[model samples]
Target: MDRIANIHTLTKRLIVMTAISLLVFSVIFGISYFFNGRLMMTWLGFVCGIIGGFVSIQQRIKNVSDEELTLLTNSWFQILLVPIFGGVFSLVLYCIFLAGIISGNMFPNFYIPKPSGSVPDANFMIELFTKTYPLTGQDFAKFLFWSFVAGFSERFVPQIVNNVADKSSEKVNPSDR
Candidate 1:
């Protein structure tokens, strides 16, 4: 069994996340402000980070409850987070795609559908994507960036939350055991 998976091993994960988030947030915000003279990007990142924390908790619930691990390790719940994570990442990437294209002052070749569904008359979803996000150089770059960020955030969030949960739990010292 992975020691890190143990609830007692959470401190290190939290520490690492806190340090990395702080550093990354500061550097990105600084660069953005220097160029745009505004705190929008920084604020966005902070908000995303905080939201990411909650998302991480959700993932942790899934991780801790994984059948293979749960049977061997005592936990509080059971869930499959892969679909949830996929949905979240997809949305994140979509938003990033939109934001990046807009920022680059370029219209995407693809057309996203509105909630009404009447706005887009396409019969297929893939066709919709084809119409919405242009597979251009800038679009591809933005897509990659979004994928990387979303994936990193998703994968790490659970680890952070698990660590937090573990740290909060009462520890059983070896002498006591």
Candidate 2:
């Protein structure tokens, strides 16, 4: 009876936490959209991450074995970390995709500004960042999909990161090879 009650409390906490998180993200994303179109991709990715977190938590509590649940020492703080990790992982994966290391299809497409010799001004840096940051419409959905996947699969991004690290190691130390 105690175990069941504890489980209900945890589930309710997660639901409330996730709802608050979604509202916050949406508000921020809405404000950011007007200032910089490029931020939309990043914003959407984080939202997807939060959703993934919520889904992951719901799924976890549903099937958590009695023995597994019993042996674990846990708290609301611990459970809340899943969505937090989800959002962070989504951002990291976005960077990896932006770097074009994953796949040609996964790379974010963007508008290429024509080279112009313009005098520096207050707007120059802002304009440059705005141009460089946003993804073109063509690949927007693709990136969004991958970002959600990254948040959902806890193992996937870590595996890719490790693989990237391994590949990078060779470039740093030729003597080892």
Candidate 3:
């Protein structure tokens, strides 16, 4: 009974901490979006991916055994790695989009604007934000959706990579016809 109560307490702590972490990252992303718009897509993708990871973990927690739940929630090392994994997968997805492997009403290209001063002026900062932001409103939503999907489904990017590899191999070693 005591152990079960402790597990429940730990689980609640995990949920609260993850929520706080998400809020913190959202604030960071908002602040950095314009200042570092050069990597805006990457940043957005990472944040979305982190959200996906958190959501996925939460869903799994519901269906898991108490032992598994305790292990998953208590393992800070594993929890910390979630964001890194999310970022990496999101980055790979961004690269794929940039490479024209995935195409839609999306802008895969970006240009960094030059600042007038060491600290960019407002117009220059606006220019920087406008130039580097690759998507319009709807398209950005799409990117966020896909990036979140990628993070939620661990197999998503790996499947894409495998598919690309298969295609590359076929191209390199064409069968005699």
Candidate 4:
């Protein structure tokens, strides 16, 4: 009976901590967004961070088995499918059916001018990252900063909250009894 009660108490505490963490996380991300440029990809990173944190909390409480973690990690392969499909799209564009739509709009411009019928320009490879749109220099920096903060908060906050809860319960429950 005591063990069950403790389990229930822990669950409740985790729930409350998760909610409060989410609120704080939102406030921090919102402040960043307010101060930064209004780019859609940067905004998406914040949303993804909160969602991933929520998922991690749920999985932690459920005491997900190793098999479950493997499955969850494997699910990231779905993201790789985008690049696979993109390559096919690029092929179609090269075939002239898409007429440079995929290459021009989606990917970095890789126009490497040949040096008098020699190899393509050496700077072409370097320019790929230096010239990406939508995720230009500033947006990439802000995205990295916010992602670091979110990852740190998600990994550490719950442990800290749970430790505090455990200590408080031990001190108060013993006194009350």
Candidate 5:
């Protein structure tokens, strides 16, 4: 009877996790479609979301209760937030690289062309934000790679860091020390 109850509980958790994963992937796909209007971005977001969801569940599966699973699945919003923040961070870095404000081997060669006559302003920035660039296969691959990194690391990296910090801060016995 106990084994049966455990199986039932495990099944429920699996179903909930699957639903949350799909929800996360759909939201990502919708946002990417709205912004870029490219199938590649949609696919990239879907793959990233799945990878992120799997990583999250795998990390928590061993000790998670049904209630905790619900909470964790609901927190999948971080999957979206991380990638958006990462995209903004990448944009800022690209801008800084282009402006000659920071020059070194650290920055890649961003291929954005200089404006012919007018200086960039708020309007230009707005246009840049709304406009979808023509991405090559290599560029799309790089974008997807970064998206995966952002999504996968959103929760995983922080958890690992916290675990390491917590372990290090634990006091050792006088004899052990």
Candidate 6:
């Protein structure tokens, strides 16, 4: 009985998180395409948002204590932060790409040419979102690799940072006299 209830709760959490993630991904992709006129950021945001939302939900399920289960049951909204953070990270990477900080060695032909002197309007942005870019086999492979990195990095980097912070804090505070 208890096991069935736990499973039921997990199922609900997963459904809520996935729905919220889809909404977030769509909105972020639309906004990113509007501002950047690029599909890369939109793709990255969608991938990262979905992956981050699921990963965070999994973490919550694993870490939930009996006392915390009631709190977690009603906290489906908290999972939205994971995707938002991931999308922001993707945007930062897109900015770095625009700034020429990263080269397209693996994807030399991945560039999508933008129209000159024509500012993108809502229709243009919508069209851009609906349109698909042509990618060679190699370019597609590189994109998949980068997308996975972007999706995973959102969760991975924070764990690395927290681990480093914990180590440094322990060294500074020396628990044992």
By TM-score, the best candidate is 2
Q: What tens-digit string does per-residue lDDT give for candidate 2 at 29-54?
A: 77777666546556677878767877
lDDT of 6 by residue, 1-177 (tens): 364476468667767767766786677778867987655445654565456546655655656776555554556565455555665555444433334445667631344445444886776655544443435667555544544454445655355447656877888989652
> What TM-score would every model get versus the actual structure?
0.32, 0.74, 0.71, 0.29, 0.40, 0.50
Q: Candidate 4, overall lDDT?
A: 0.41
Can you write out model 1's per-residue Cα lDDT over 1-177, one digit (the tens) per residue?
Answer: 564464333434434544665576578678866975654422443334444443455345445644544442442222123323533554544554454422444323333544346554545543443334445766544444444344436654345346645654636443453
Off by over 4 Å in 4: 39-177
- How many angstroms is residue 44 displaced in model 2 relative to the true structure, after the best TM-score fit? 1.8
Task: Give the per-residue Cα lDDT of candidate 6 at 100.
Answer: 45
Candidate 2 vs candidate 5, lDDT winner: 2
Q: After superposition, how far is residue 45 of candidate 2 from its true place, in Å?
A: 1.4
Model 2 lDDT, full chain set: 0.71
Query: Candidate 1: where is the Cα deviation over 4 Å?
Result: 1-5, 40-55, 58-63, 66-177
Q: Which of the numbered candidates is closest to the native, going by highest lDDT? A: 2
Residue 41, candidate 3: how far off, in angstroms?
Answer: 1.9
Ranked by lDDT, the better of candidates 1 and 2 is: 2
- Against the hidden true structure, what lDDT does model 3 obtain? 0.69
RMSD of 2: 3.8
By TM-score, the candidates rank as 2, 3, 6, 5, 1, 4
Clashes of 6: 0
